[model samples]
Target: MAAIQALQALAIDVMLPALGNISHDLGVTNPNHRQLAIGVFLICSGLGSLFPGSIADRFGRRPVVLTCLTIYVALSLGCSLVSDFTALLVMRGLMGLFVSGLMVMPMAIIRDRFSGDRMAKVQSLVTMTFMVVPMFAPTVGQGVMLVAGWRWIFAVMAMLASALLLWVWLRLPETLDPDNRQPIMPRVIVGNMAQVIRCRASTGYLLGAAVMQGVLFGWLNSSQQLLGEHFGAGEMFPLIFGGIALVMAGMNFINASIVERLGARRVSQTAVIVYILIAVAHLISLMRGEGLWVFVPFITASMCLVTFIGSNFASIALQPFSRTAGAASSIMAFSRLLIGALLGTVIGQVYDGTAIPLFIAMAIGGSLTLALVLYSEKGVLFRRLNPPPLKVKAG
Candidate 1:
C-alpha cells in the first residue's frame, strides 16, 4: 500500500531536481514556466482522482490498480521520448491520471478495515513509509542527472513503476469487501461522491488539506530557485530537501506511535496551532532579513507539522463511511491536487527570487485551515467525536 502510494511522491519529487535541466534542454526560455510540468501533472491528477475510486469501486481494486500501473509505466517512457515541451506536459498529465489509481486504491483498501483513531494510526504508518520517497527522490534524481540526461529521470521512473507493478501483481491481495461492491453508473457515482461533500467533517478537512497542499506545492514549484539560488545552497539542494523530508517522515513516525492513545484530534489539532505559530515566526524572520539557517528551521518545522496534520485530517474525513470510502478519498485527493495546483502555480509564478511567497502561502493556509476545522466542529477543537477502537483478539 505504502510503496504504491509513494509512486506519486517519486513522480513529483524526483523530477524537481531536474526541472532546470528539463527547461534548458527542452528550450524553455522563461524560468517560471518550468513549474508548468508540475502544474500540469497536478491539475490532471486532481481531475483524474475523480474517477479512479469509482472505477475501482465498480471493478475490483487489484485489477484497476494493476491496469493503472501498467499505463503509468508506459506514460513514463513516453514522457522520456517526448521532444516537444507541450508533448511532455501532455504525457505527464496522462501519467498523473493513470497514477491516481495508485493513490486512491490504497486508501479504499485501508478503509475496508479501519476507522477513527485506528485509521489515523494506520495512515501515519503508511505516510511514514511514503515519506521515504520524498527524502531520497531528489538525491536520486540528482544522481541520475550526473550520469545521464534529464530524460533518464523519466526512464528511472518507468523502471521503478515496472518493479512495483510486478510486486503488486505477485503479492497484494484483494481487500474490497464482497458486500460493498459499488456500481459504476453515473447517478450512483455522483450519489456516493455527494455523501463525502455533504458531510461537514469530511468536506471541511478536505478543504483544509487542500490549503495545506497548496502551501506544499508552492514550495515544490519554486524550491529549486528558493533553496539553490535565494538561499545559496548551490549543490546542497538535495541534502536540504532530503533533510526537511526526513523531519516530515520522523513526525509521522511519532504520530503513528502516539495517535491511538492521544487521539488523532488532539495531536493533529495541537500541530495545527503550532503550525500557525511557526508560520508566523517564519514570516517575521523573513522580514528581519535572516539567512538560510534561520530560514530552514522555521520552514522545516512548519512542514513537520503538516505530517501531523495531513494523515490525521484524512482519517477524520473518511471516518463517516466504509462502503463509500473510495468516493471520499477521491474527492479529497481531487481537492488537494486540483485546487492546490492552481494556488501553487499562482505562488510560483509570482516568485521574485525570494522565499516570501511560499511563507505567505503557509501563513494564509494555516489560518484558513484553522477556520474551516473550527466551523466543521461547531467551534470545538481537540476533543474526539468517536470513542476509542475496541481491542480485538486473534481468532
Candidate 2:
C-alpha cells in the first residue's frame, strides 16, 4: 500500500527536475504556464477519485485498485508518447483519474482493519514509507535526465505502475466484506457524504486538512522555481528538495511512534499551532530580507509540521465512519486536492521573482488551518476523542 501511494509522489516530485526540459521541448515559452502540468494533474486526480471511492465500497478494494492500476499504466504510456503540450495535459488528466483509485482504496483497506490511535499509527507508518519516494524522486529524475530525455520519466512511471499492478493482482486481498458492501448509486453516495458533513468534527477536520494540503501543494508547485530562480541553487535543486523531504519523513516516523501515546488530537492540534508560528516567522523573515539560510529552514519546518497535522487530521476525520470509509476518503481527498491545486496554481502564478508571495500564501493557509481546527473541535483543544489504551500497573 505504501508503495502504491508512493506512485503519486513519484509522478510529481520525479518530474520536478525535468520541468525545464519539458517546457523547452513542448514549446511552452511562458514560465508560469509550465506549472499547468502539475496543477492539471492534481485537479483531475481529485475529481477522478469522486466515483472510485463509491465503486470501491460497492464492488471491492482489490478489483478497483487493480483496474485503476491498469488504466494508470496505459495513461503513463500515453503521456510518454504525446508530443504536444495540450495532448500531454489531456493524458495527464486521464492518468490522474485512474491514479485516484490507487489513493482511495488503500485508505479504505486500512480503515477496514483499524481505528482510532492504532489507525493513526498505521497511517503515519504508511506516510513515512510514502515519504521515502519524494525524498529520492528528484534525484532519480535528475539521474534519468542525465542518461535520457524527459519522456523516459513517464516510461519509468509506467513501468513502476505495471510492477505494482502485478503485485496487487497476486498478493492483495479484498478487504471490503460482502456483508458491508455499499450499493453503487448516486443517492447512496450523496447520503453517505451528507452524513460525513453533518458530523461537525469530520467536516471541520476535512477543511483543515484541505488547507494544510494547500500549503504543501503551493510549495510543490513553486519549489523548483523558488530554489532555482530565486536562490540560484541550480544543480543542487534535487539535493535540497530531497533533504527537505527527508526532514518531513523523519517527522512522520516520529509522529507514528508517539501518536499512539499522545493521541491524534493533541499531536495534530499542537502541530498546527506551531505551524502557524513558523509561517508567521517565515513571513517576517521574508519581509526583513532574510536570505536562504533563514528562509529555507523556516519553510522546511513548516512543511514538517504540515505532515504532522495532515496525518492526524485524516485519522481524526475518518474515525467516526467504518461503513462510509470509502466515501469519506473520497470526499476528503477531493477537497484537499481541489483546494490544494487551486491554491498551488495561484501561488505559482503569483511568483514575482521573490519569495513574498509564497510566504504570504503559507501564512494565510496556516491561519486558516488553525481556525478550522478550532471550529472542528468547537473551541475545545488537545482532548482526544479516542484516548490511548490504559497501561495496567504490575503487581
Candidate 3:
C-alpha cells in the first residue's frame, strides 16, 4: 500500500531536479509554463479519481487498482518516449488519471480493515513509508540526470511501477467484501457521493483537507524555483529538498506512534495551529529580509505540521463511511487534488522571486482549515469524537 501511495509522489517529486532539463529539452521557456507539467498531472489525477472509487465500490479494489497500475505504467513509458512538451504534458495527465486509483483504493482498503484511531495510526504508518519516497526522489532524479538524461527518469518510474504491480498482485487481497458491493451505475454512484456530501463532518473535513493540500501543492510547484532562483542553491536543491522531506517523514512516524493515544482530532488541530504560527513567523522573516538560514527551517517546520494534518484529517473524514469508503475517498481525493492543483498553480504564478507568496498562502490555508474544523465540530476544538481505546490514555 505504501509503495502504491509512493507512486504519486515519485511521479511529482522525482521530476523536481530535472525540471530545468525538461524545460530546455522540450522548449518550454516560461517558468510558470514549466510548472504546468506538475499542475496538469495533479488536476488530471484528481479528476481521474472521480470514477475509480465508484468503480471500486461496484467491482472490487484489486481489479480497479491493477487496471490503473497497468495504464500508469504504459503512460509513464509514453512520457519517456514523448518528443515534445505538449505531448509530454498530455501523457503526464493521462498517467495521473490512471494513477488516481493508486491514491483512492488504498484508503478504501485500509478503511475496510480499520476505523477511528486505529485507522489513523495505520494510515500514518503507511504515509510514513510513502513519505520516504520524497525524501530520496529528487536526489534519485539528480542521479539519473547525471548518469543519463531526464527521459530516463520516466523510464525508471515505469520499472518501479512494474515492480509494485507484481507486489500488489501477489500480496494484496481484495478488501471489498461481497456484501458491500454496489452496482456500477451513475445514479447509485451519485447517491453514494451525495450521502458523503450531506454529512457535515465529512464535507467539512474534506474541505479542510483540500485547503491543506493547496498549501502543499503550492510549495511543491514553487520550491524548485524558490531554492534555485531566490536562494541560489543550484545543485544543492535536491539535498535541501530531501532534508525537508526527511523532517516530514519523521513527523509522520511520530504521529503514528502517538495518534492512538492523543487522538486524530487533538493532534491534527494542534498541528494546524502550529502550522499557522510557523507560517506567520516565516512571513515575518521574509518581510524582515532574513536570509535562507531562517527561511528554510520555518518553511520546513510548516511542512512537518502538514504531515500531521493530512493523515489525521483524511482518517477523520472517512471515518463515517465503511460501505461507501471508495466513494468517500474519491470525493475527498478529487477535492484535494483538483482544488489544490488550481490554487497551487495560482500561487506558483504569483512567485515574485521570493518566499512571500508561498508563506502567505500557507498562512491563509492553515487559518481556513482551522475555521472549517471548528465549524465541523460545532465550535468545539481538540475534542475527540472517537475516544482512544481503553489501552490508550488520552493526552
Candidate 4:
C-alpha cells in the first residue's frame, strides 16, 4: 500500500525539477501546459477506477493488481523512451490508468481481512505508510534530478515498479472468495457504483475525501512553480516540501494512535474545521501579501490537518462497506481523484506567480468538506462533543 502511494506521489513530484527542461524540450511556450501533463495522468487514473471494482469481483484482487503493476512498469518505460513531451504525457496518462488499480486493490484486500474498529485501525496503519512516501518524495526526486537527467526519473520509476511486481507476485494473496465474488457485467458494475453513491454515509465520507484530496491536489499543481519559481526557493524546495510533509506525517501517526479511541468521525470532523481555519488564515495573509516564511508555516499546518482529515474520513466512509470492499474502494478512490483532478487543473490554470489562488482554493475546499461532514452527521461537526455513536442494532 505504501509502495503504491509512493508510486503515485513520485509520478508528480519527480517531474517538478524537470518542468523547465520539459517545457524547453517540448517547445511549449506556456508553463501551465506542463501542469496539464500531471493533471491528465490523475484524470485518467480516476476514470480508470470505474471498471476495476467489478473486474476484481470477477478476476480477484491478486490478478487485477498484478496486471496493473505490469502495466505501470511498461508505461514507466514508455515514459522514459518518449522523445517528445506529448508522447510522454500520453504515456503518463496510460500509467495512471494502470496505477488506478494499485489504489483500489490494496484497500479491497484490507477490507477483505478487517472490519469496524479493527478495519479503521488497519486503514490508519496503511494510510500512515502511504503518508510517509509523499513526505520524502519531493526531496528524493530533487536529489535524483540533480545527479541524473530528467528521463532517468522515469527509469527509476520503471525499476521500482518492476521490483514491486516481484514483491506482489511473491506475497500478495487472493482475498476474494468465489462465493462472495460478483460478476463483472456492465449492469452490475454501474449498479455497484450507484449503490455506494446512494448510501448517505458513504456519499458523505466520499465527498469529504474528495474535498480533502482537492485541497492537496490543488496545492500540488501549484507548488512546483509556487515554491521554485515564485519565491525563488529552488534549492530549498525539497527541504520546505519535506518539512511540511513531516508535520503531516506526525499528524498521521497521531491519528493512527487516537482514531480508534476517539472514533474516526470525531477525529475527521475536528480536523476538517482545523483545516478550514488554517486555510482561511493563509488566504487572508496571501491577500495581505505575506512573506514566504509566513505563508509556508501556515500552509504547512493546513496540509497537516488535511492529512489527518483524509485518513480518518476514509476510515469512516469505508467502515460500513467491508462486504463490498472492492466496490467501495473503487467508488471512494474514483470520487477523490475525479474531484482532485478537476480542481487541480483549475488551480494550475489560475497560477500567477502568486500564492493567493492556491490558498483560496484550499479555503473553499476546506469549507465544503466541513459542510459535508456536518450534513452527514445531522449537523454535528465533532463526534467528541456530542459522541452520538452510530448503533448497529442486531436483527
Candidate 5:
C-alpha cells in the first residue's frame, strides 16, 4: 500500500512545475485547459479502480500490478512525445487507467494478510511511509525541470515506474489464494461493490474521504497558480508547497502514533472540525486581499488537519469489511477519486484573479465532509475502541 500510494502521490506533484511549460508548448490558450491534462488522469484512475481487482484475484496481485506498471511507463513516455493537447490527454488517461492496479492492490495485499486493529495500525504506518514521497516530489520535479526540461518530467515518471515494476516483479509474492480467487466477471464485481456501498459506516468514510480529497485535489490543481500568479511567489512556489507538504507529513507521523490509542474516529472528527475552521479563516483572509503571508499559514494549517482525516478514515472503512477488502477498497478508491476529479474540474473552472475560488471550494468540501461524518455516525463524533464491525447489508 505504501509503495503504491507513493506512486499515486508522485503522479500529481512531480508534474506540477512542468505544467506551465507544457501549456505554453502545447498551445493551450486557457490556463484551465492546462489543468485538464492533470484532471483527466485523476478521473481515469477513479474509473480504472473498477477493474483489475477481480483480475488480480484471478491472475494474482503481483502479476497484475507489474503489468500495469509497465503500461504506465509506456504511456508516460508516450505523454512526453505527444505533439497535441488531445494526444497528451489521451495518453495521460491511459496512464491513469493502467495505474489502477497500483492504486488498489496494495490494500488488497494487506487485507489478504492482516485484520482488525492490526490492519489499521499497519495502514497508518504504511501511509506515513508513502507520505514522504509527495513531501519531496515537487522539489524533485522542479530540480528535474531545471536540469532536463519539461519533457523530463515524464522521463522521470517513466524511470520511476520502470524501477517500481522491476521491484514488484521480483519482490512481491502472490497473496490471493487460488481457492478463493474470483473470476473477472463484471456482474460479480459490481454486485460486490453494491454490498460494500450498502454498509453505512463504510460508505460514510468513502464519502468523507471523497469530500476531503476533492478539497485537496482542487488545491493541488490550482496551487501553482494560486501561489505564483496570486501571491507573486513564482520562484518560491515549489519551496512553499514542499514546506507545507512536510508539515502534512509531520501530522501523518503524529497520526501514526495516536490513532491506535485515540482510535480512528476521534482523531478524524477533530481534524474535520479543525479543517473547516482553518479553511474558513483562509477564505476570509483571501477575501481581505492579503497575500502569501495570510494564505500560506492557513493553507499549511489546513493541510496539517488533512493528515488526520485521510488514512484514519481509510483504516476505519477498511476495518469492517476485511473479508471484502479488495472489492471494498476498489469502491472506496473509486468514490474518492471521482469526487476529486469532479471537484477539481469545478475549481479549475472558477479560477478567477485570486485564490478565493480555491479557498471557497476547500471550505465547502470540508463542510460537506463534516456533515457526512456526522450523519453517518448518527451524530456520534467518535468511535468506541473495538467498535462493532460495520454491518454488511444484503444488496
Candidate 6:
C-alpha cells in the first residue's frame, strides 16, 4: 500500500535533479518557467482526483488502482519520448490524471479496515514506509543523470511504477466492503463529496491539510534550485534534500508510536504551533542574511513538525463517513494538491534567487493552517474527541 502511494512522490522527486537538463533540452529559457513542469502535473492531478473516488466506489479498489497503475506506467514511458516542453507538460498532465489513484486509494483502503486513533496510528506506520521513496528519489535521479540524459529519468520512473503495479496485482485485496459501493452517476459522486465538504470538522482539517500541503509543494517546486543555487550546495544538493526527508521519515515513525497514547489531535495540534514558531525563526534568520548552515536546522525542524499533521489530518477528516470513504479521500486529496499547486507556483515564480520567498510562504501557510484547524475545532485546540477502541485489529 505504501509503495504504491509513494509512486506519486517518486514521479516528482526523481525529476528534481534533472529539471535544468529538461529545460535546456526543451528550449525553456526562463528558469522560473521550468517550474511549470511540476505545477501542471500537480494541478491536473488535483483536478483529476475528483473523478476516481466514485469510480472506485462503484467498481472495486483493486481494479481501479490496477487500471490507473497501468496507465501511469504507460505515461511514464511516453514522457521519455517527448521532444519539446509543450509535449512533456501534456504527458505530465495525463500521467497526473491517472496517477491520482496513487494518493486516494491507500487512505480509503486503510479507512476500510480501521478507524479512530487506531486509524491514525496505522496511517503513520504506512507513512514511515512512504517516506523512504522521497528520501532516495533525488539520489536515484542524480545517479541516472550521471550515466544517461534527463529523458531516462522518465524511463526509471516507468520501471518503478511497473514494479509497484506488479506487486499490487499479486498481493492487494479489495479492502472496500461490498456494502459501501456507490453508483457511478455524477450526482452520486458530487453528493458524497458535498457531504464531506459540509461537515465542519472534516472541512477544517481538509483545508488545513491543503494549506500545509501547499507549503510542502512550494518546497518541492524550488528545493533543488534553493539548495543548489541559492545555498551553493552544488553536487551535494541531493544529499541535503534527502536529509530533510530523513527527518520527516523519522518523525512519522515517532507519530506512529505516540499517536495511540497522546491522541492525534493533541500531538498534531502541538506540532502545528511549533511549526509556525520555527517558520518565524527562519524568517528572522533570513532577514539577518544568514547562510545555508544556519537555515537548514530551522527548515528541518519545520518538516519534522509537519510530518505529524498530514496523515493525522486525513485520518480526522475521513472519520465522519464510512460509506463515502472514497469520495471523502478524493476531495481531500484534490484540495491539497490543487491549492498546493497554486501556492507552490507563486513561491517558485517569486524566487528572486533567494530563500526569502520560500520562508515567507511557510510562515503564511502555518498561520493559515492554524486558523483552519481552529475553525475545524470551533476555536479549541488539542482535544481528542474519539478514544481508542478496546479491541481494535492490529494490522
Deviation in Å, model 1, residue 129 alpha carbon: 0.9
TM-score per model over all chains: 0.97, 0.96, 0.97, 0.94, 0.94, 0.97
True-vs-predicted CA distance for residue 139, candidate 2, Å: 0.9
* Alpha-carbon shift of residue 221 in model 5 (angstroms): 0.4
TM-score: which is higher, 2 or 5?
Answer: 2
Candidate numbers, best lDDT first, in rank order: 3, 6, 1, 2, 5, 4
Of the two candidates 3 and 4, the one with more favorable lDDT, higher being better, is 3
lDDT of 6: 0.88
Candidate 4 lDDT by residue in tens digits, 16-114: 767778778778888888887789898888998867777887789999888888888888888878888789888988888877988888778877776
Candidate 5 residue 161 C-alpha distance from true site, Å: 1.1
Local accuracy of candidate 1 as per-residue lDDT tens digits, 1-395 = 89999998898999888998898889999999999999888888888988888887777689988998899899999999998889999998888876787888888888877888898999999999899998899999999999997889999999999999999999988877766789878999999999998888777788998988888888888988998888999889999999999988999999999998998889988888999888888888898798889888888898899999999998988888788888878888889888888888888899999888788888888999999889788899989777556454365
Cα error of candidate 3 at position 116, Å: 0.3
| Candidate 3: segments with Cα more than 4 A from true spot | 387-395
- Give the alpha-carbon lDDT of every model: 0.87, 0.86, 0.90, 0.78, 0.80, 0.88
Q: Give one digit per residue, the lDDT tens place, for model 6 in 136-239.
A: 99999999999998889999888888887888888999987777899888787889999999999889889999889888988899898888888899989899
Q: What would the TM-score be for candidate 2 when compared with the true structure?
A: 0.96
Report the C-alpha lDDT of model 3 over 109-221, residue by residue, as the tens digit: 99888899999999999999998898899999999999999999999999999998898899889989787899988899999999888898877789999989988999999
Q: Please give the distance, in angstroms, between residue 265's alpha carbon in candidate 1 and its true position after superposition.
A: 1.1
Which pairs clash inside model 6? Answer: none
> Tens digit of lDDT per residue, candidate 2, span 1-395?
79988988888899999999999999999988888899899888888877777888888888888888888888888988888899988988888876787777778888888889899999999999899898899999999899988899999998998999999989998887676789978899899888888899888899889887877888898899989778888988899899998999999999999999989999999998887787777788788787766767987898899888888898899888888788888888888887777878788889887888988887888888888888888989999776444343365
Which parts of model 1 are misplaced by more than 4 Å?
A: 387-395
| Number of the top-ranking candidate, with lDDT as the measure | 3
